[model samples]
Each structure stands twice: as structure tokens, then as C-alpha cells.
Target chain A: MTGLRLAAVLLAVFAASFALAQGDPRRSGYREMGPALQKMQDDDAANPAMLFVQAGAAAWAEKAAAGKSCADCHGDATASMKGVAARYPAFSAEAGKPIDLEGRINLCRTTHQQAEALAPESDGLLALSAYVALQSRGQPIAPPDDARLSNLRAEGAELYKRRQGQLNLSCANCHDDHAGRKLAGATIPQGHPTGYPIYRLEWQALGSLKRRLRNCVIGMRAEPWSYDAADYLALESFLMQRAKGMAMDAPGVRP
Target chain B: MSRALAALLLLLPGAAVAQQDSMPSLTGKPGDPARGRAIVANRTVGLCLLCHGAPIPEERFQGNLAPSLAGAGSRATPDQLRLRVADAARLNPDTIMPPYYRVDGLTRVARSFQGKTILTAEQIEDVVAYLASLKD
Candidate 1:
């Protein structure tokens, strides 16, 4: 074959491989977790994350600075919050960007409750997030379809594929290329964000989805973005969209 | 240096380590294949078996994402293999293999590991030496 034809063929092969790498069907991290952890997630009474869920229920009722609680504005969380977590990391016209469940909770804390914004990964924030997400349990994830979210989602997709850190690993490297493969004795999951405020046995505490993202980046030997960074919000949006049809499994247990 | 001395160099904080960019070729004495073999088999260290199916039959759960390391010496030259192990990004921009030496352009590094490379210079040489010895 001529040099030009060979180059063309090589380019096509490269493009095909790249597309194949990105086109893997999504699967939940739940399926990738160990059986012992799966049992913990199935039983609310046995799950340690339930403590935060209970705390969040209390926080929902306790009055904030303006003599109002989350219960005051949205009464009967069971009725109001069902399937709510499935639609978060959404575009906020008020903020002019995508906001995750933690972002929305802080927004309400300051705007509606007249209270201070909770710190990222704080007990109060994790509890509240866990409680809210628990309500969406069994609901299929369905991130918003606003035209405004298109740009943010695109940015997120880029970040997910972009290689970073000294290790030079991207989200796709582990979650996409090696999903179901072993790494340091643990199965590398597809990394769908079907659960947040998950009860990771390794952490021994409830953590937001952003916290988990930060941990992965750190494992790659890369610097992690701070809490509420736009990059994180974009990634969260992308992950939620990836898991769009998967059942919500917040207060999830993982080893 | 003895194996104990190499272990001491890794354990000692701020041990006059060479930065990733400064050293291009493998530095220090010729790599000891025995030490390299141990590092490659170690899960917490080289993590080679995590992704590549090396010739270590004793290790379970070997991965298949990358090519097997059996008879790797005949497949590529020592320098080519060294670069590939140090940082395969130069060969394939999207490879999942972590750079064993290069340190810049990373994000979210931990407080204690700001300037440290994943594998020490000696460890990299050892791993390379071990790969070079894999005749079959």
C-alpha cells in the first residue's frame, strides 16, 4: 500500500479505537462492590449511612435562622423529595451554572432558610444530602434536559476524557477501559454516579459524590479541585447523565 | 547499593532525590534483575500485574488490558522499554499506564507526596532490568 493510504488507514483505526474506548455501556458502582458491602446497602437498619439519613431527617425539621426548616418550605419530605436526587447537578438559572445536590442544598440554606452554607463533606451536609437522596431510592436517574445544560455537559465530557496528573490517567482509563478489572485487589467499577452521600466503608463516613471524585483524582497522583468548583459540577453533571436510567442507590455502601 | 540501602532511600524523606525531568536515561548502577523481579510482582509498588499479564504464574488475577510481558526483551530495545515504563504517554498519549518517573503536570497530589515520583529512580531501573531479562 502507498504511504498516504497507510496513513489514512491508521487514522481510521485510531479513530475507531478511540470511539470504542468511550462507547462502553454504563453500569453502577453498586454491582462492582463486594457482596458484604452489597448486603449492608440493602439493609437500612444495618447500614451505617443510615445514621446520617436519620440526622438529615432531624435537620429537615429543626428550625434554621429564619425560624423555618426544610420541612417548612417543603412539607412531608417523602412526598416532596421523591425522585429529586435523580435530577440534580442541574443547571440553575439563579447561579448560571450546574449545581449538584450539595450545591442546591447550600443554596436553599442561604436563600430560603436564612442560614449559613454548610461546609463540604461536613456531617450536617452529608446527613442532609443522604436524607434527601434516600427519598429518591429506587427511582431511575434522569438528569435535566435543559438546553442551558448542553455546554456544561460538553465541558464535563471533555474533563472526563482528559488525562491528568503525574500518573497520566483519565476517568475513562479505569472506569471505561478497565471496568470490571482488578486494581490493587479491588474491581474497578464503571464509575456511574447513581449513589451520593454514599457510606464508603473505607471512609467510615458518609461522603458526597464530589468527595469520591476528589479521591479518584488523588489516587491518580493529581491535584483535586476544591469543593463546589465548576469543573466538579460539570463532571457530576456528566456522571449523573451517564447513569440516567439506573436506579438511585444513595446511602450506598461500598468497601 | 544493597536492597536494604535502596529501601532506606525510599523511606527517608527528602533524600536528595533527582527530579523527574532532570534524569532522562536510567541512572544509578546497572539494575539488579532480582530486585526488579520483586518490585514487578509487588501489588502495592510497581503494580505491573494489575494491568499487564506478566509471566508470574504464582500471582492471581493478572489483567489483560495491556500486552503480556513474556519475552518482552525480544519485542523492544532496552531504551524503548525504559521510556515506555518511565512514561508511556510519549508513545501513546491515551495509554492507561501510569508514568513511573515523570512528576510535573499532575493534579490533586497529597500533602506528603508533592515532589515524589511513584517509583523511585532505583525502582524504575530495577523494573526495567527485570523486563529486559524476560526472555520467554
Candidate 2:
């Protein structure tokens, strides 16, 4: 081959390899944690999230204002609620958009039980979210293939790449570009939403995905979206889609 | 009057630096390399090691998210370093580095950090000096 042709072929091959290297393999944040934290997540007895799960279980059976409990309509959670969490951020026909597991819980409360919606990050909300999420502990995340969700999911992907705040960073900059690297003392994880209602060491309590998302925005010195905002729902849908096929690690432990 | 003004300036931690690509020394005095080194090495204060790998041997897990701080002295002048450290967004609008000396035009700044720059004017000088000394 001519020297110019040979060089052109080699350049193309190099470019392909570089692109492959840039594509991050899908990996859960659980694998990025320390052994002690991993062990804490692994053991149900040791997991702090279990406390919330127990509370949720109690709330599930208790009669609400309308004189109906969650169990009254759904029956045994172990059988009925299995794999439900894995398919969350589902298209809510009533809301005309996607609603996450927490949203679903609140919707059930307001509509079926005639109760007020639980406040964001409240003990009651965290408890029920943890309890329901536990049922799908090891199921692979399966975002629904509803065409109605296409727009919000796309918006979410755009938000992930959009730079914001004083620091001018996008989610891709830290979670995608710098995953597996250290930022101060902590390693920047790939930031998959495999875990929700996670037990964070910094928080000393269980918190939802919305809470985690808000913390990230604050860290970037940006104004966080309000609770149950469509933007939050969009991001949650995108994260769930991005984490497709990754096992659910709800009530996860993190430092 | 000058004495009162100087005292008032002392109370304000992060006095304004010129809004330019290259800026004069923030403290109007040459920075102390030793003090600069201390700031760069500090995990919480400077947070330089969080994004840039520097010559600090004690810090094992230096970040690789941004450029290495090694040979920074040769790459840019002291004036350029000052501006980059104070407000890098002026140079690159999408830079992830936080503005160490700028205070206004930010959104939703945490309650404790409102109206406060990330670093003092003197701290910015120290950081710039430390970065300017990384010739090798």
C-alpha cells in the first residue's frame, strides 16, 4: 500500500479504538464501594435501610383515612409487588407523564386511601419506598418501552449533558468522564440509579433518588428543582433507562 | 482615611480581582511558595488536588479530571495563573473549576456560602504562586 493510504487506514483504526475507550462500561456504584460498605448492603440485618423497610411494611398493612390499606387492594406484597420497582419511572396515564416508585406510592395514597401525599424525604415516604423497592432487590432494571415516555427520557438525557451552575459542570463530566477516578478522598462512581431510598452515611438516614439528585445540583452550586417536578421525573426516567439490565440494589448503603 | 480603608479591606476576605483573562496579583505582593504549597496540599481548603494532580507527594489519590499541575509555571505567566485560579469561566465558559475569587452572578448559593467567594484574595495569590512555581 502507498504510504498515505497506509497512514489513513492506521488513523481510522486509532480513532475507532479511542472511541471504544471513551465508552464507559455499565457498572453499578455498589462495585465501586469499600468492602465494609458492600458487606453492610449485602446483609439485611446490618443494613440501616432495613429499618425503613420494616416501617414501610407496617404502613402497608395499616388502614388509611378511606378505611383501606395498601394490602387490601394489592394482597401480599411478596407475591404482588415482586419486580414492580424494577420497572418504575413508568408512564402514568393520569399524570400524563412518568412517575417514579415514590410518586406511585403517593398516587395510591391520595387516590385510593383518601390520604395526603407524603412529603419528600419524610419518614413515611422513605419507609414505603424502601419497603416496595426491597421486593425488586435483585431484578434487572427494565424501563418500560412506552412511546409516551420518549420525550421526557430524551429531555433527561439532554439534562445529563447540559452544563449548569457556577461550576459549569454536566453530569457526564463527573459520572461519565471521571468515573473510577478520585475526587478528593472519594472515588467518583459511574452514577447509575441502581439504588433508590439508599442509606447514605452522610445523611444518617434513608433518602430517595430525588433527594440524591437535589444534592448533586447543590454540589454544582445550582438551584435544585422542586420536589415531584417534571424535570426530576424526567431525570429519574433517564437514569432508569441508562441503568437498564443492571440489578436493582434498592435500600443500598453508600458513604 | 487610608488606614481606615486598609482596615476595611482586611475585613473583606475576597476583594475583587480585575475581570480579565490575565490579572495582576490579588494581594499586590508576591505570594509565599511555602504558604501556597500548604494550601494546595490541604484537602478541604484549596481542593486543587481534587481535580488537578500536583507535585504534592503526600497526596496519593490526586484527581485526573483536569490537567496536571506539573510544569504549570512554564505553561502560563503569573498573571494568567491568577485569572485562571480566580475565575476560570472567563477563559473557558464551561470549565468545571469553581471561581475562587468571584462572588456575584451565582445561583442558589448555599446559605452559609452566600456572598462569599470560595477563597480569600490572599488565598488566591497563594494558590497562583504555588501553581506558578511548578516549573518541572
Query: Cα lDDT of all candidates, in order?
Result: 0.83, 0.86
Clashes of each: 8, 0
For B1-136, candidate 1 gives per-residue lDDT tens digits of: 6999989977665434323223345685778889998898987788788788888888888876678899888886666678788887666767788878877766655655677888998888888888889986
Best by lDDT: 2
TM-score of each: 0.80, 0.80
As a whole number from 0 to 100, the lDDT of residue A227 in candidate 1 is: 85
Which parts of model 1 are misplaced by more than 4 Å? A1-24, B1-25, B41-45, B53-64, B68-77, B103-121
Error of 1 at B134 (Å): 3.3
The alpha-carbon deviation from the true structure for residue B21 of candidate 2, after best TM-score superposition, in angstroms, is 7.7
lDDT tens digits by residue: candidate 2, A1-255: 699999999999999988865674888889899999999999999999999999999999999999999999999898898889999889888766678888899999999999999999999999998999999999989999899888989999998888756555678889988898878667898888887889999999899888888998887767788896888888888998999888999889988
Cα misplacement distance, residue A55 of candidate 2 (Å): 1.5
lDDT of 2 at A234: 85
C-alpha DockQ of every model: 0.31, 0.31
Question: Tell me, what's the RMSD of every candidate?
Answer: 12.7, 10.5
